[model samples]
Target chain A: MLDAVRTARPRVQVITNPVAQGYTANMLLAIGARPSMTSSPEEIAAFIAVSGSLLVNLGILDRHRRDASLTAVEVAREMGVPWVLDPVKVDISPPRLDFARTLIGMEPDFVRANHDEFVGLGGADTGEEAVRHFAARNLTTVALSGPVDIVTDGTRIVRIANGHPLMDRVTAMGCAGTAVAAAFRAVEPDPLIAAAAALTVMGIAGEVAAAASSGPGSFAGAILDALYGLDAATILEKARLT
Target chain B: MLDAVRTARPRVQVITNPVAQGYTANMLLAIGARPSMTSSPEEIAAFIAVSGSLLVNLGILDRHRRDASLTAVEVAREMGVPWVLDPVKVDISPPRLDFARTLIGMEPDFVRANHDEFVGLGGADTGEEAVRHFAARNLTTVALSGPVDIVTDGTRIVRIANGHPLMDRVTAMGCAGTAVAAAFRAVEPDPLIAAAAALTVMGIAGEVAAAASSGPGSFAGAILDALYGLDAATILEKARLT
Candidate 1:
């Protein structure tokens, strides 16, 4: 999947929170995927029309972000471009949860969320059940990420267990992970494979980074280095999947 | 000044660009200052009322940022709180330049800018002259950051020659520097000393980080580690100030 993304060099239109923008862009660039963030609602459609995929992250919900995100997602759906929806912190804000539900109704190609967020979005108890339930209900792919990550597309389920605890300390690590999934979705047509590949890459990189880092500060840098340096053989050697 | 900041543990209200927010917050936290970013105009004044200082960064200006920045700066001034103004990329955008000029007129305690931004803001030729010119005109401290950073408070000028070229490769480094200055300003009333100490720390940290990093990605993490581990002895031994 990483090879496919590198080959495609897809340009992804990302409407993420301010906190996530810089790291997300850097991560995409490091992995050979182009990332653009044009928040102006007037120009979002035009930008999305030319991009390969879209990543809609509701991290800090503002009026401008809300309007632009809705417009971008609709445009992506109409254009047949795959998009990833990340319902960040949906459980914390009722308005944000409502916004996530509204976006879920629009039918994003992939829904990426944490275990808590998956439950908040009306999923079942276990990561496997939550992903399977959400994917079946939405008729799309659902990814539940945590210590053990599960991705399902109604029929097929993929489990990846490979990350580090240091990932939790950084502010925008999960948000960047969502963008990676969108990048993979741009290259791989199968939603289950795309979601699984993205999560595997994130996990392996996190594990590699945690080994080399002293704390959260250095862990962020090492993760980027691992992403940039990761090859197919290294991924195969380190990735723990089922 | 660094000692004062460590002792006070000042909470800074930062209304910065989306790209700079995470790093700025991390940098402040590494240096023992608390950072909060409240972009909502409705909540900014109340947030600033309790903050020890304010940092206004104009990197990516939208309607929300413009409105909230103006409101925050006004409240900071009214409440007699020290505020730092960072005119990021002011030369490229005429609208942003005009807005920065208006804010300058409101009299921020410190003005931080690059060489081009200093010139755009009507500073004279050299960094020294530019800082002195702006300081004299506005009756506020002016910090001109580049290869060599110069800080001035109308009469006194402090030159710090210590940063690394790696700093330029990373996005939002200058904006983060401006926040560091504000953090120092919160604990130390002397603008010149505060600006100089902040710049000195940033430079020494950059130099130290450059030694430990392989590229810009790793350099970012090393910078955070350097800042968190920096001590007065390290500063005294490494800093090159005039």
Candidate 2:
């Protein structure tokens, strides 16, 4: 995935939580993508105008933050630029889940959610059921990240039996995956292809991280090491997309 | 530096510009530092309460952003955790210089500045003169970064001359240096040692970047590669710090 972005530099605008802003933006840069992260609603139109893709993550959302995300999505829609929505922890709270559903109505080009989040957003009993619910929503692509990721684009579905269990131990790994998806979207026009590419890269990196670390504490660094070390040829060879 | 941070994980709070937020935070994580980047004044006190070190960067300061930096400094002061300030483009505008001066009065444990920024903050006519002027400041340590970096804690001074010219071609290289400094600070309590380690590491990586890239477009990736690839033995052998 890094190789793809390095080969084809893309301008990506990320409107995310303040917590992971620094790391996410830098990771995008390390992979050869131009990153812009701003939560100010006043700048959303201008940012979307210059960017090729948008990543919206509601990790730490508030009343004010929701407005910013809506503004960004509106501008992205007007510009005809693709955007990825990450409904982080939407299931844990009522207001958050309601907001996530409202955001879904905005017609995001792609939606990246973990098992719990997908269940919450889809109002499904299981991960597989959640994928089916999302598919029915007419999303361009929906990724259900877990031990095995399920990616679907309404009619077509690809299940990636890659990645490591250690990824579940780390906080914000799913958010990072969403950021990687946005990076892939910047380079590839097809949301389905981009989702597969990001999940493959992340899964390969997760496997590398699991081999190098003992616990969640050490896994984060190892994950970054894996991302930095992994190349396109290796990605193509190791990726398990079906 | 990465080895040290991996061994001793530290929680770092960064109050910085939105542009490099993702990359800087990720760089800290790559080296095993927990990074929290929050610009909300409402959350500054709570965030700094758990942080081991504070990093403030004046890269893209606007009227609304100044409040957050000031709040962070206030919280860091109350906590007594070591804080480093990066006075970026201080000379380019009056408001920026004034904000930097106000933050400096709050007493940062370390100050990381580029040649241009050092001269501007230290009230000196040249880079060398800025080093001399900053040596007299009340801060615990001052790092003046350029092709060669000079780190001083009043009595003891170290000069690191290892980076390449290509480093100047890239944007936010100084912010990366500042993030590295925060990483080092998270592990080592000594401000001088942390500043020296960060300057040496960033400089050596810059040299490595120069060897691999033709311009700024490629230098960014090469710089991260150099950082991820550098080891303590190699850094000590090649580092010009004295």
Candidate 3:
């Protein structure tokens, strides 16, 4: 799947996350996937139509991006583009949770989020059974990332435990991971496999980054370097997917 | 000046560059300066009032941010707060140029830009004379960044030539530099010396980062790490300000 993504070089459109915009784009580039961050409503539809998949991040929810997100989600559906919904920090904001619900009702292919975000968006928990049940109910893949990662789509499930604690120290690490998943989703048909594979690659790369890092600042950059230097041999040896 | 910034730990308010917001904030943190990225018009005045300095970046100009910028500038001026204006890529768009002109008319403390952006904002060249001329006409300092960074306030001019070429490969490097300048301006009373000192620190940090970097990806993160680890001993030895 990593090879497929690199060869395809599929363009992934991500909306919101003004804070993490550059880092997310750099992370996508590290994994050999092109990132398009067009969140403007005037030109987002065009960018979305041309992209293979879309990622709507609800972290920095604002009035202008609200309009852009609604338009983007509809355009992606109209164009048959696969999309992921990342309900970031929805637990803290009622309005953000409501907006996440709106994106959820639009039938995203996957909902990539952490445990708190997953549960906040009405999921039971980060437990495997709960994740699988949520995926079955939502009719979308549930990528619940934590100390261990679980990617499931009702019938199929994959567990990947290969990252480092340093990842949590970095801002937008999960957002960046979700973006890589969106890139994989662009080229892969199976939502479960796409999320699983992308998480595996990012997790392994993160482990490599943590080995050489002194702190979050160094870890953040080293992870991008590790992803760029990541090869098939390393991926095959380090991958913890089941 | 660096110690002053670290001791004061002044807050800098950046009004634009959603793309570079996180990196810029991280860079500010690396140097012990607090970064406040508040672009919403409703509350920007409140943020600006408490902030030590403000930076208005015209990189990703949008209708909503335009309102926020106008409001931020007015509030910053009303509060007698220092501010820097970054005319990013104004040559590419007439409307953006017009907007830059409007900000220019409002008396920014400094106009920090690249050679093209400097010329685009009506400067003749990046030469010492042109920068000085621009500074005198606008009643502000001109900080022209390039292979050699030039900072002048119509009279006191400093040229810093201590950065690595790898700095350009990293996205938002210039915008990040402008943000750092804002942090320094908060502590230093002189705009020319503030811009000069900040660029000298960042340029030296870039040189340090380049020593350990394999590519732009690594360079981007390494620069932040380098900035975090930078010290007075290294700054005294490596800075080429004249």
Worst 10 residues of 1 chain B by lDDT: B38-47
Which pairs in model 3 have colliding backbones? none
Q: Can you write out model 3's per-residue Cα lDDT over A185-206, one digit (the tens) per residue?
A: 8988888888888899899988
**Pairs of residues at least 3 apart in sequence or in different chains that clash in candidate 2:** A21-B21, A21-B22, A22-B21, A22-B22, A22-B23, A23-B22, A23-B26, A25-B22, A26-B22, A26-B23
Task: At residue A29, give the lDDT of candidate 3.
Answer: 74
Complex DockQ per candidate: 0.18, 0.05, 0.18
Tell me model 1's lDDT, rounded to 2 decimals.
0.85
TM-scores, all models, native as reference: 0.67, 0.66, 0.67
Clashing residue pairs in all predictions, respectively, total 0, 10, 0
DockQ of 3: 0.18
lDDT of 1 by residue, A80-159 (tens): 98888999867555677889999989988889998767788888776566568778988878888877888888888888
Expressed as tens digits, the lDDT of each residue in B109-189 for candidate 2 is: 888876677667754654454565566665557888765678877777788888888777766677867888987887787
Error of 3 at B156 (Å): 12
Across B148-237, the per-residue lDDT of candidate 3 in tens digits comes to 888888988888999997676555788899988999999988887888888999999999998988666788878988988888999999
Docking class of 3: incorrect
lDDT of each: 0.85, 0.76, 0.86
True-structure lDDT of candidate 3:
0.86
